[model samples]
Target: MPTAVQALCANFPDLTPPATLALRLEALMPSRRLPAGRVLFAQGQSPSAFYLVEDGEIEARFAALDGRMSVLEHVRAPRLFGLAAFISGKPSRYEAAAVSDSRVRVIGAPAYRVLMDDWPGFARALMREFAERFEGNLRLLEAARHLSAAERFGVALRQLADERAGPSDAEGWQALRATQAELAQLAHLSRQTVNQLLRAAQAEGRLRLRYGGLDIRR
Candidate 1:
């Protein structure tokens, strides 16, 4: 099995640094295990560290005034979370929790700053990550503004498949580990609408529903 440093390098290929620098980074970041449903950080909490998910899933959620929580993002392994708040020196905008039992590498604010100041490659990689996420958010907003319910559902399904689906089978079908309700939330549609869309897609040979998920044709 690869060490944490190796996994980090694999996830962020642009973060190339000298051997000594990589060693220093490994020393600065520590790994932690979180049980499923455990909250990593809550909304409005001060940012102390950013997390690199090494295994399992994390959910970024927003709580409404009515005491309801909505998932804003699903961050799978090999992704970084909490960096925006940490870098901006602001309180967290959403709560982060482990969707499943998870392992993560914690990079404290001081260590992040030291690397950003000393390692040009690391800084560039982080900037690129931020830019990519920003562009994605803009596209999502555009979709929501102009796309129909079915079109929005299609886009959401495709995005989720691309991000977190299992390997494609010989028939070009990939397993997506998400329920109809979760898909509805991601598509910003009602559950009934999502169900109708799923049935339509299935009838068209685009996807098939499973017990807890769906197999989508790529």
Candidate 2:
């Protein structure tokens, strides 16, 4: 069986490092497994390590004053996160938690910077990943600002499906692993509104509620 680092390299073929570089990365970074619901970091905390998720789900969330938590993003495996605070040299604006049992490779900010400086390929890949995430966030903000509640939720469902879908069939139908509350939070809608939209989609054959989550059909 392949190691977590090896598996991550294989998963992101475009970002794979040469053997020597890969070995160096494995030596520099350490991997950990977290149980579901584990708080990886809290909002307003200072950054210590940036994580590259090797497996399972992770979410970034912001908690409102009334104790409501809104999800900012759902991250699947072979993805880097918890970097914005590290890059800005400031406290984190959101918290990260394990949505399921997860494995991740962690490197401190100083070491991460050293790796980027020493490996051009790694640096470029990291930069590209950051740029793509920034663009996605901007699009989400636009949808929230201009789209109707139902339309915004439609966008959220599609986005969740895309995130959870396998690489070979990303555009195909998939199940959502999130709860209705999570979905509502991400879409900026109330749970009652989310339920209404989901029921409407079900009537149209776009979604089906399963025991675990919603089964969506594209």
Tell me the whole-model lDDT of each prediction, alpha carbons only: 0.81, 0.78
Off by over 4 Å in 1: 117-120, 142-146
Candidate 2: which pairs clash? none
Candidate 2 lDDT by residue in tens digits, 1-218: 34645755654577655556566666667888889999998999977888888888898988989987878898877778988897787899999999889988887865586567765587777777788887777767777899999878977777777667433336455666767887787788899999898889899987778776877767
TM-score of each: 0.87, 0.84
| lDDT (Cα, 0-100) at 23 in candidate 1 | 67
Which residue runs does candidate 2 get wrong by more than 4 Å? 1-4, 167-172
Compose the digit string of candidate 1's lDDT tens values, residues 95-123.
Answer: 99998999888989666866688776777
RMSD of each: 2.3, 2.8
